[model samples]
Target: MNLTKAIAGRRSTRDYTTEAVDEKLIFRLIDAAVQAPSAMNQQPWTFTVIRDQALLERISQEAKACMLATTPVGAHSSHFQTLLSDEDFQLFYHAPVLILISGNEPNQWIVEDCALAAENLMLAAYAEGLGTCWIGFAQGYLNTPQGKHALGLPAEWTPVAPIIVGHPKSAPAPIAHKAPSIHWIG
Candidate 1:
């Protein structure tokens, strides 16, 4: 598929089918994610794939509780609140597959590298007729002790992003993209 089409088609899917995503497909998505650019060629990243139903449920519950605790009263940030519904709070659309991305501490550009990886994965999933939502709200929960145990994250790996993937239960409509703000030298 062309890059334009993929870009136009990609959306943050919040509803997903219960159908299981193939392991091979998940790996393929990761393969695509690694293709993203990193600073100084330093690829400091790790991924934790969660497929166990019980574990996913636990993570979801823990995450929701964390959100409730962290969300300041009356503060509604779309990235942290609007996307987290009762049904989608922790598991995030219950997509049956969740990809947890972490980065090494020493790399100053870990955040950028991890974000690029996430975009690559989301777009790749869309191209493959799958749906994905980049989940950043989970950071609050994942930063805690329970979250760390749930994902089996190493002490050295900091959570950068988590993504939920599955077949779309509802197709996302195209959203308007803002015009680029740039100053070009002739």
Candidate 2:
């Protein structure tokens, strides 16, 4: 697929089928993710793939509880509150795979680097006819002691991106892209 096409076409997929993503395909996506550029060539990302259905459910419940408790602060809290409050809303959207892109070591650019890699992964999934969504709601829980313990992650690692991948139940309907705002500088 053309780079521009992939950039414009890839959408955050929320609706996924029950079918699991093949292990090989998941690795391929990660391979694409590592190709992303990093600040000072510091490839500070590590990956944790979670396929356990029961575990995902537990995380979803815990994350929703955590988000509900903290929703009183953020500007967008009310919006998320509604979704988080839904008893039926699964944080991973029933996706068969949840891949956590984490920091290998702390650095100012670790978050940015992981995010770049996340974009690469998502785009690659789109190219491969898979769907993905970066589940920000899961981040807080995933970083907590319990969450890390659940994933068997070391204390030094921090999960920056919790992306869920699967076969989308339906192709995403086309949506409008906002026009870029330009400010000229010489």
Candidate 3:
């Protein structure tokens, strides 16, 4: 797939099929992710691939509970509250694979670097005819002590991106994007 097409056509896949993604494809996605540029070549990302269905379900439930228990204070809290209150919501969208991108160190650019890697992974998945969704809802729970222990993450590593990858049951309609706001300068 052309880079432009992959970039523009990649959608956040919520409904995934039961078919498991091949391990080779997952590795390819990781290869693309790590190719992303980092600040000072720090490359501070770590990838945690979760394929256990039971564990995925547990994390989904725990993450929802965690989000709901927190005091609603932000502008996005109401939206999240709706999701949390919904009994059928699954943070990973039942995807067969969950790729958790963590930052090895706490630094100002860690999140940004990991996010760049995430975008690369998502686009690569799309190019390979797989679907992906970046599940931000899992971040809070995945960062907790229990969550870290459950995933066997190092104490210093912080989960920055929780992405679900799988075969899409159906393709979502193209989402219209807003026009970019540009300020021209000399």
Candidate 4:
């Protein structure tokens, strides 16, 4: 597919089919991800591909449990409590493959690099007739003891985002765009 078509087709998909995504496709997406721009070409990013069903279920359950452990009296706790009921957040829309993007350093530039990599992978999946959702909740999950061991990430690695990739159960409708506010340019 052409770049324009791929860009136009990409969307944040939270619904996925049970069909297993091929490992080769995941590798291809990661290859595209690494090609993304990095800060001074430091390439501090790491990709963790998770495919085990038992591990995925464990992570989902543990994430909910950890989020529920927050003090109920806290202002933010109620929000977390409500999140546990959401199915998408619970199982990550049941995507077959969960790609965790981690950065070696917590430098601000590393976040930018990881974000670019995520975009590249998402577009790559879209072109391959797949769907993707960039999940931020995985970061919180990684902070918990269970999630840390589940992904087997090193102490130095910081989980940035979880990219859920799989066959699309339903394609999201086109989102309307608003014109950006801009300053004058020469």
Candidate 5:
């Protein structure tokens, strides 16, 4: 697929089939991710590919519990609370793989850098006839000490993006986009 088409077609996939994403595809996406631009060319990024569905389930359960314990009463929106409180809710949406983007070292632009890499990964997946979603629900938990231990991440690294990739059960319908708003001075 062309770059413009990939950019326009990519969507945050929430539903996926049971089929597992291939290792080669995961690596290909990671390679594409690293090709993204980094601040000062400092590519301080690491990709953690998680293929075990059971582990993902455990992480989802634990993360949900942690969030429930920490969230202030009434702080979350009703829908969010319902989602988190529901034991049936799977944080990764049952996607067969999670490609976590992390910082290899501390830097002012680490988050931004990793985020750029994440976009590349997502677009690459879209181009590869795969589905991907930036699982925001997994980030906080993945960054915690327990979460880090579970993922076997190095002590110094920081998790920035928890992206799930898999085959979609069905293609998501195109969502309508609002016109861009810009303020210009020149």
Candidate 6:
């Protein structure tokens, strides 16, 4: 797919088939992610690919529990609280692969850098005829001590993005997007 098409057609896939994504494609996605621009070229992102079904299930359950135990502070929090409470909810949506992006340093731009990489990964996956979803709900739990140990990530490495990639069960309808507000000053 062309860059324009990939950017315009990429959607957050919530449901996926059980087919496993190719390891070569996964590496290509990571290569695309690293191509993203970073502040001062720090490029401090680390990609952890997870394919264990048991671990995915455990992380989903634990993440939901952790989110539920926290006090809701706003409408966004309240919405997540409701979603996490649903017994059928799985954070990774049963996708066969989960890519966790982490930052090695506690730098101010680490999160931003990781986010850029994640966008690249998603767009690349879409271009490759794959589905991808950014699983933000897993962030809190993945950053916790227990979660870190479960994923075998170093304590200094902060989890930035949890993305699931796989073949879509079915094509999702195009979602209408609002026009962006623009301001220009000369």
Candidate 1 local lDDT, 36-86, one digit each (tens): 998888888888898787887877777877786678756465555665556
Residue 180 in model 1: lDDT: 95
Q: lDDT tens digits, residues 59-115, model 5?
A: 999989887776666756666778999989999999999999999898999999999
- The estimated TM-scores of all candidates read 0.87, 0.95, 0.95, 0.86, 0.95, 0.96
**Candidate 5 — which residues are off by over 4 angstroms?**
72-76
All candidates: CA RMSD in angstroms? 2.6, 1.2, 1.3, 2.8, 1.3, 1.2
lDDT of candidate 6 over 1-186, digit per residue (tens) = 889998989999999999999999999999999999999999999999999999999999999998888746886886877789998899999999999999988889999999999999999999999999999789999999989999999999999999999999987779999999999899
Measured by C-alpha RMSD in angstroms, how accurate is candidate 2?
1.2
Q: What are the Cα lDDT values of the candidates?
A: 0.83, 0.93, 0.93, 0.83, 0.92, 0.94
**Would you list the clashing residue pairs of candidate 4?**
none
Q: Which stretches of candidate 6 lie over 4 Å from their true place?
A: none
Give the Å shift of residue 58 in candidate 1: 1.4
- Candidate 1: worst 10 consecutive residues by lDDT? 75-84
- Model 1 has how many clashing residue pairs? 0
Candidate whose lDDT is highest:
6
